[model samples]
Target: MENEVNTAGRPGSFRFIHAADLHIDSPLRGLSRYAGAPVERLRNATRRALENLVDLALAERVQFVLLAGDLYDRDWPDFHTGLFFREQMVRLGRADIAVFIVQGNHDAQGTITRELPLPAHVKVFSSRSAETVHLAALGVAIHGRSFPQREVPEDFVPQYPDALPGQFNIGMLHTSLTGAAGHDTYAPTDIATLKTRGYDYWALGHVHARAVECESPRVVFPGNLQGRHANETGPKGCELVTQSGGQMEARFVPLDVVRWHQLTVALDGVESLAQATQTISVALAEAVVGAGDRLHALRVHLTGRTPLHTTEAQQPGTLEAAVHAAAQDVAGAELWIEQVHLQLASPIDRARLAQGDDAVAELLRLVDELAADPAALVAWSSKACGDVLHKLPAEAKAETDWSDLQALRELLADAEATLLARLGGAV
Candidate 1:
């Protein structure tokens, strides 16, 4: 770790874009299988998002761009992915905007076999060790290292060189940074360690949610440029950073052409499907307005205690269709419902039932016990679905992991919801 500084060139103020997890040419998971889904648009979403990123860089006239990691999604499916990326790089190059990148876990050196010649302006950091790129013209220094393998269990921060003195220093890394939920811990380190490196800004990736760990040093995760699934909902984009008078300021800029949203609509007093549809329509309209000109892919969760619970549970497909129809009718911008979840509460007094020494109470207690225990839930589900499992084709059976705790948890929740809905009507 050398503490070398190259203080050259006149720099009063400068601006650059910091982006990560481009996942270029990657398709949004599980959307294509749904009916009425804009498969073509979704399939091209990453490409379009990359194009938008380039457009923003060109339009903003940023001196350079920092891509933290995960530029490709699990290696190249084909050469077209690499070519598309090269084209975007060329676009940036023509505008004289250099792109500095460090490959994350998803696109580690060994993972991506195919390669295309990127524009001269693009500089991918070496996977062997931490390397620094000095932009003499901008009086800035960027230090980064690509992941050599998919899983980086060890902290590599110590290996990074000390920040250059008298220059605006930036450190680019792809890490989970002390274990973020829903993300694997990769290149794990602490914010304190990053701050001690004396870098002006830390451009981080791997975690798909935007966050600013520290404002003074400006450690930031721009998040993914696009939301690739339901879990990754909300506005996805990059950070536009400006350096003036030795102070760095960052602003989030949305680059996703199509946005994914998860909306919860309460139906507390709703009694009929018509009212539900109307409520959903209003919610969709609001979402459309909020989304601006971007197309929206939404998953609507219908919640709250309602008399329509039984009807919704029994005819979910119909309800979902109606919700989709409502979206189509009221949405000023283009919208599609990825799914409609019915989480309507039963009218039955569950607390009172739990207190009683009756068969229903016993059953409820057993269900609660099973839901808490993953092993019990898995055993129960396997026994319950034994006949269905036997009938499943070999390929399907191979693909299904029957012991998955997450899957069992979801199954139990759905079953509990349905059972409560039916029991409420009978009671």
Candidate 2:
């Protein structure tokens, strides 16, 4: 319903919703440590997003809905999760909107063995082998296979049947597709292999980020229905696709209830911490306005070199309190400060300081050397910190990869900032 409709090519047409990675009831990861986090709202986001999906299907009068994978986070502790899913399926059933699903790693046979009597309108593909379901009325053939276990190292595309000559053949897969940034490899296969597989379209899952791999015979990942954490930021939603003749039109519909955002306020040449608070307040107001109507969970990172780093010591908790206060009056929209990262630095010209012969310059040079070389930084970390990464809390370590070169560089910059803040008084 979002994009411009294309009706020029041919009269033959149909509309369907494509969504994936509905990690229902999965708590927003790494938010528990933060005080006053929107734990409840985000925890229920997936369910609400699913409700939005069903509502869209009914409202648009789509032929069918495709839930590519990861319908559940894991094996449900109780029957509530299963019941909620079935209730939505029943809603779709009453409206005659069919749903096709393939279980991803989280809801695989071995991972989530729990059983439920889903509505007849909902057809979950086989886990043991590739299964094809024919929607004779719509002339659509959907082929897919669920994950038998938690991890699938092999390719399932090779096993999928060839495209039917007269029908629109769609391949539903839960794959990492050779690999993705944060996810492990599952159902690994190349794009070339998928293109040659003879499917009209590919609806892929497992990767939370949306990607359209091909256009000729459309291939896509609709991303997750909702954002479960800070890492999965921005507008989270599904693809509303309309296929007519040889042309396909796809529109991304944002269905997320609580949108995750990372806002950075550079202190720069601000006179005082209180002055920066005014800036922070204005930024929060603008961010809320920009986010439209839905709730925004913000992780604010205040960065920049400023004399306010030393000034911050005058009023210990002023910055943190100001951040929370800014979100209090968001007019019509609602917002929550998930966490405040004070990644600020003292107003020191380090490049000039490094030109000196003092102890400070020597220290600055050593920091520079480590910052420039990734291997040196790792070696310094190993010898100096004694398994520093392992010592950190699991949640904290999961947020950052200390070993990666770029990540290490960022980490060094952060550490350097902290040191500058500490020595600001002396300077």
Candidate 3:
């Protein structure tokens, strides 16, 4: 029940829950690679998380719940999933809280939800076209539509109704809004379009990070009810929107039952293994706290320069094991440490490596040359590497000097050594 109140207002203030990106029935990947850590725990955790959202709504006595989209993970083959969803909807209905949902790219037309009969309290907006639902009794009007196809290339905002007069109008949509990293640019719409629509509040979905795009005429993302992967880090849940006299405000409420975590431990200028381990311990503790109520998975990234870099190069698994052991020792912690990625650099004497008859130096030189040619670098992976490379933060993709290249090359060699000698003899 981590309530992230972002707005200043009184209680019982026309409250409703704005939640989205419930990728329900999504496969819980990469959790508990080690024994005694059951994946079922994580699967049930997501369901429990949804229940927690309902509980939150009931506790707050919200007037309604706005599920912008992605309620299911595409079409579930079995009815059990749909049944589970029905039960959740019934719970909300029992609380007399209405639920409004639209279809996302994942659950477009012809999906399982199309056939499932939701509770009377649940309102699934039509994919055939945009529509508005006016709750005159509540003095609220909601405008939205569902994804008609799996991919939407045009702006869907134009399909939304212009704000109704004298009503607290909210537009519920599952759109990329503007383009977002690591996601398809579906239902593309801009802030200006939403603003121009004259809607008092925009309950948006499809991106899994909670954000307040604007305050006045409020455009907000409630993020996801649960974090499904490593890329989705930190607090996740719905927004609590409260309105008064056609004016609106919103707050974040974290409802994640389990969290995905990544901790980057920088090791610049470190002296010893003890020092590095100590730093890693502090970082692990910090990651757990940052995960809020439910952080079950973790990936530790060891970055920067240090004496431990050499030690990690020689026997990386020992260091990884120690870190895992440390995380495991935390009481009642479901922390599953998957891997300790080495992004570190040893003190490099570049001229010495390059000048001498060192095989490592030659490898370093080649990698440096390859890294220099942006065109050649793009050929390594099948993805839109150029697009991805261009999108990287300037600081990460910044040009490097010979010494930096030497460090990067060594880092690559060290990674191979770590995988082969320390992680396993597989690489």
Candidate 4:
């Protein structure tokens, strides 16, 4: 295959790809449990992402590819996962592009147990200690270390060898870099330690968000090759780095076949259940456009004051069905609503309504009282809905979190809204 890229600017210009957290064949977010989920496609998204990475290496004619960590999700249930990875490596091998990899926590627990032979062009770093691989032909030195086991509480940087003179040194590590939100502390080290480590560029992994921690020496986390769940939203890909005359430049490219998104659709001016669904449809279309052409797995949170909150409460699963229909309505748009979170509010002012003296008003006042006192709310719920609660096990209480004050308050509000809907327009 013939591919062309501009090597404009310097004499010894060369390109390389820096990627991490492939998590190949990862079972994403347990989508299989959901009836309407695109389970097969999402489960295969990680493998597709890896293929895209290989294709990019061939297209860009990159000298080498760096996979910082987590190449596999867990120990293979079968040999297909390993076979798939080996095929991709062979593809890169045929293109004369070498690959460098280090085992992250997942890999340490997973693929290490079911080892498979990769192409000669690929090198996986040793787990016992840090090792440096030298490519004298390109004057490049890559230093890395794989995790011996799943947990690495200590620093791996201090054990790494110093940079060799007259070479473009790159440090590959699977670390949280001190600590990061939504990530466990593994191979933790601060930026200060990295800055003094003497590497020209640092490629990090483990954290599933794209970040450029430093610019002067170019410290980066390419993010996961593909998003595994709704929590991991937005474009997921790798860093394309080009070395021109001794200066390095990097850019991110979107490679994920399926993208995950969390969208908030306001229902303030919505008139009916149909209109509410239409508004969410418009929002989904716009979100998909902004995300580019790919399958969008969305978790939409409906919020704001609307009359449809009552309608949605009365007709359970209607909103979900409406959203599903909307996602399919837009031709050529790949959309799937992963979930519909309802945070909708009634249009009426409950405080003002409660001031009146009527059955509805008395009900509102009672709701307000229960909401203010958690203990009273629980006791009331037990008295009101004891038949249903008693039929189920005590463990079921955790599911709805009846003990949480805020959860009970929300439940009371939703119940109040449903009652108001049946009473006639909140007047």
Measured by TM-score, the strongest candidate is 4
How many clashing pairs does model 4 include? 0
Candidate 2: count of backbone clashes, pairs at least 3 residues apart or interchain:
0
Q: What are the per-residue Cα lDDT tens digits for candidate 1 across 163-209?
A: 88777888999999998989999999998898788887889999899
lDDT of candidate 3 over 1-427, digit per residue (tens):
3333333221224789888888777876434444555577667766777888999999999999998888788678778777888899998999899999898888777655447778888998998888999888877888889988788898888877888776778898888877888778999988888888887788899888887787766788888888876778877888876665434556677888878788888889887766666777777777786555565677788778665656766765666766776675565456777557777665656456656565655655655666675554434322424566567666555542323544444444564344333533221
Worst 10 residues of 1 by lDDT: 1-10
For candidate 3, what is the lDDT? 0.73
- What would the TM-scores of all predictions be? 0.86, 0.84, 0.81, 0.88
Reference-based lDDT, each prediction: 0.82, 0.82, 0.73, 0.84
Clash pairs of candidate 4? none
Task: Give the per-residue lDDT digits (tens) of candidate 4, residues 1-427.
Answer: 1122332222345689999999998875545547877788888999999998998899999999999999988888888999999999999999899999999999983336777788899999999999999988887889999998989999999889998777778899999997999999999998888877788889899999999888756789989999988999999999998887766668898899999899998989687777877887888888888566678989988899887777777776777787887777776678888888778887777778888998888998888888888789989777867787777655454345557677667767778877887787573
- Which residue segments of model 2 deviate by more than 4 Å? 1-12, 29-32, 244-247, 313-316, 351-425
Worst 10 residues of 4 by lDDT: 1-10
lDDT of 2 by residue, 70-116 (tens): 99998999899999999999999998888999999999988986788
Residue 17 in candidate 3 has what lDDT?
89
Give every collision pair in model 3: none
